[model samples]
Target: MFDISGREWIEEEYLRLHEQGLVQEKDVVKVIGVHNQMCERCLNQSDEWFGTFTYKEQLITYCRQCLDFKMVDNCHYLYRSLMPAKITDNAHVLNIDFKLSSLQQRASDFAKEILEANDLGLIWAVCDASV
Candidate 1:
């Protein structure tokens, strides 16, 4: 039986983690359950172990086996990866063993040719499409 205050505190921490790239965006989505009123990943196996979080005067169910996910009754749930992004020791090097696919290589080659030729229209890569 958790209180609403505890939920708010945890959510604030989650938001902070999201800002620091330790979690997904602060907006976690609820995956509607189909059959079981349990965590989609863990699917509570009647272990009789769990935690509760109060949301709007209702207790949101959380599984003990898997904590990163939560369920609201059997129909709704919110999920976020608890695992944080990996940080390499060398910030300059991203991946040591990385291979590009044939199609990707061709596209890269085409872009390189265009850049080398000083083309007026250069293909731009959009990394973050937050809008």
Candidate 2:
């Protein structure tokens, strides 16, 4: 089951991977065990080793570079760190739906634009889809 945000869910998966030896403890980069506490990306960046906790299930390890950008508002990495409930009032039900809708619309619009563009080729098409 998922918590308020998708990040927690990913953390849980990381922990499982750690326990299974699919990921080492050193693979995690940052951990903010506290609920709603802001993360310190600079401090987090100093650490080279990380492992997700089986109980907490969030990234517990990160290098300085990754951590430095973790808290940036427009960063895609930061978006990954966001907990669903933290971003929305009704995470499990309402907020996720809203976010998905927004993402789908963006994807649809981008696809349409790509299709309409004459100069873009296969490689560019794949990159566009990733965005």
Candidate 3:
């Protein structure tokens, strides 16, 4: 079972992406599923979400609440997690023929638009452009 808030976030992200012309309606369901799976895997892989952090180190592995409050402070991780492996694989295979820079720029623009429309406080630093 998926957390309600997590599920809602995934749906919202998918819709935002669609609205930005980054992804199509047909891809929404697949993207949402992948996002949910990735988030669940990330949570399971990190013990910090449920355990305590030592005070000696300022580094604290935040819980789900903390992470949510941070609004996915790391956009690179979020982008990588949200992007389908197949797209990356295809890009690699077509590297010689495709304009990687142009594609990345478009993706960046799309991401920025989505973030702006949603009023997402965190910027996607990994993007080529800022919203």
Candidate that would win on TM-score: 1
For candidate 3, what is the TM-score?
A: 0.26
TM-score of each: 0.27, 0.24, 0.26
Candidate 3: give the clashing pairs.
none
**How much does each candidate deviate from the true structure in C-alpha RMSD?**
16.8, 16.3, 14.0
lDDT of 2 by residue, 1-131 (tens): 33323342135555665577655444344444322322333323222333233324544333323332232211112213333336445432434332335556665566667767843322122332422
Residue 90, candidate 3: how far off, in angstroms?
12
- Predicted model with the maximum lDDT: 1
Lowest summed lDDT over 10 consecutive residues: which window, candidate 1? 1-10
- TM value for model 1: 0.27
Task: Per model, state how many residue pairs clash.
Answer: 0, 15, 0
Candidate 2 residue 12 Cα shift, in angstroms, is 2.3
Candidate 3 Cα errors over 4 Å, as ranges: 1-9, 30-41, 45-84, 87-131
lDDT string, candidate 3, 18-86, tens digits? 577765544323321223223322443344343334555543332353354333321112322233434
Which segments of model 1 are wrong by more than 4 Å?
1-30, 33-35, 68-131
lDDT of 1 by residue, 1-131 (tens): 21122121134455565577655544344344312545454455464745567878876566665443433234353444333344457633446475766655665688778767976333344443222
RMSD of 2: 16.3
